[model samples]
Target: MKIGIIGGGSIGLLFSCYLSENHQVTLYCRTINQVNMINQCGITLQKKDSSILSNIHAKLSTERVADELVLVTVKQYHLPELLPILDKIPQHIPLLFLQNGMGHLDYLQKMKHDNILLGVVEHGALKISLSTVKHTGFGTTRVAAYKGDMQKLMAIKNTLQMSNFPFEIEANYNEMLIRKLVVNAAINPLTALLRIKNGDLLSNNYYFELLKEVFQEIIQVLCLQELEDTYFASIVSICQSTSNNYSSMLKDILEHRQTEIEGIVGVLRNKAEIQKQSVPFLQFLYTSIKGMEYKRWDE
Candidate 1:
């Protein structure tokens, strides 16, 4: 199978390394420096005790995408710019979007592709360098057909699944993405602001209180009243599972890069406004994170 990963970030690099083991991978990088480094040195996947380098074809994202399957691994904010590039792909080729937040669903609805699949990456991946990624947590990639055939998705899943990296088929895309949205909205902002590891949200009693408070606001906005326990429990489980892992948002703040707060929390904020509800917690988080982002830019 030939796979075109459309982002050279942590998720893109991690997926490229693992998927390249059993398939042909063409990684689309945002910069020429990364492309040159990857094409010259190959991509390095770092684990607890082992590191392996896998050779993958690298190119700028401006190039055409002519692969069997394309994984859109860019951040949600970056998706708008890539939509034009995505439109150029042959309609028969399947496109899988692996991004946080339910906001991308809006863009997905406007797309013209024949087979569009959605996925949530649970693996904790951190890009160590332009050509190296650290797999901090081993987790499944849940995939569902948004407007495609199930057999096609299943076939893609079967070919992509490996021992180290796994993929699961989901029946409902909405249910799949919203569960991830709940996790992102509840955990990411608090951790970024508090400057703590994922586990700290659970370990510290006071932080745990704020976590619950934020979770309540998110569920209320999304109207997940009946399954609140199920979703909340999943957040706690994720925190424990990736206890030491720093969230992507926190890493973005620390690295002075733009975070995906708008894609994740901003979606909820918009929904809250539409529903005419008050979400002080989400509002504060959205503003505070944006402030930090501006501070970095202004400095």
Candidate 2:
């Protein structure tokens, strides 16, 4: 199978290396420097057990991607600019999303084609440099056929599984998405607000209290969505498991890059307004992150 990875960040690059071993893989990016490096040398993938200098086809545009399966790994905030380019990709080919938040469904539903699969990847990787990627931890990726034909998607899933990728099929997708949302709302905001790594949030009571409050707000919303409270504990477990990881938001803030704050927290705040409830904690986080982002721009 020929697979096109849209975002050439750490996770996308890592998957490209792994998938390229047995399949035709292309790492697509927007930067000329990145394309030059991959073309000059190769993608340096440092795995837990071993390392490899995998040769991957790199491109700067989707003009060359004809009938390959595409994986959208770009940040949530960039989806609007990224999704419309699918017209260049063939309509019958499958496209899977490896994103970090909810709300993609509505945008995807607006597309002309429905060959979309929603994927939740748990694998963690750190992009140390432009040419280097370190596979930090292990986790399973969950995939489900959202609005598309399942033939190509199932083939992709089976191929990944046979290639020793750690992943599973989520039985209940709404529940899975909601559960992931609560976890992101709980951990991501606190880490971004405190300017701390994901693990450090657990040691700070002030941050933990803030997270608990956010979780409570999310629980109320989840209850309205008819989800049970048992999913609440999973939020705490996510923090504990990925405690040492740098959340995408925190990473963005530290590097002075744009964050998915609006996509993740802003979405919740919008929903809160619609529900006629005041989410003080989420509101505070949204304001704080936005303020910091503005201050950086001013400087």
Candidate 3:
């Protein structure tokens, strides 16, 4: 299997290293330095107990993406610029998009790919360097086809799944993404603002109160009222599992990078307005994270 990964961020590098073990993997990087470094040094995955390094092909983003499968791991904001390049890939090849929120869903409608898959990466990964990623949490990659054959998704899962790194195919893409969106909406902004690890939200009652408030608004906007309990439990489980890890949003704030607030919270607020639902908590989080991101420009 030939797999090409777009973006050299933590999630991209993590998948490149793990998938390269079984497939002919090529990592497409935006910067020449990362491509050069990955080609010379290989990609490394640092686990709690051990570190595994895998050698794989590296290429610049400008090159053609011809592969059995391609994973777009770049942040949602970067997707607009990337879509033109991805348009060149043969539509028959499956492309899996792993983004934080539902904003990327709109992008899929325009793609010509016959087999477009949507997925949420539950595992927590932190980039240590250009060629290294730390696996901060262990979780499954749940995938659902936006518009494709189920057998194709299952086949891709079977080809890509590993004992240590697992992949599961879901029946409903919207449900899978909604669950992840709830997790991100509740956990990310709280952690980013408080400058605390995810676990802190669960440990502190006051923080937990605010978390519930935010989660309720998101659920309301998405109209997941029936599964509120189930979704909240999933959020708690994720925070508990990735206790020590800083969320991608929190990391973005700390590192002075733009967070995916627009994709995650921003999208929710838009939905709220359309539905004529009141979501003060979501509105607050959307603006708050935006304010934090705006500071980057001042610095």
Best by TM-score: 1
TM values, all candidates: 0.98, 0.92, 0.97
lDDT for 26 (candidate 1) = 99
How well is each residue in 1-299 modelled by candidate 1, as lDDT tens digits?
Answer: 88999999999999999999889999999999999999999999999899999999999999999899999999989999999999999999999999999878889888888899999998889899999999888889999999978899999999998977989999999999999999999999999999999999999999999999999999999999999999989999999988888888999999999999998999999999999999998999999999999999999
The reply for model 1, stretches above 4 Å from the true place, is none
Q: For residues 192-217, what per-residue lDDT tens digits would candidate 2 score against the true structure?
A: 77878776767788777776678788
lDDT (Cα atoms) of all candidates against the true structure = 0.94, 0.76, 0.91
lDDT for predicted candidate 2 compared with the true structure? 0.76
Ranking by lDDT: 1, 3, 2
Give the poorly placed runs of model 2, Cα more than 4 Å off: 150-152, 224-229
Candidate 1 least-lDDT 10 residues? 102-111
Clashes of each: 0, 1, 0
Q: How many backbone clashes are present in model 3?
A: 0
- Candidate 3 lDDT over 162-182, as tens digits, reads 999999999999989888888
For model 2, the run of ten residues with the poorest summed lDDT: 221-230
Model 1: how far residue 47 lies from native, Å: 1.1
User: To one decimal, what is the Cα RMSD in angstroms of model 2 from the true structure?
Assistant: 2.1
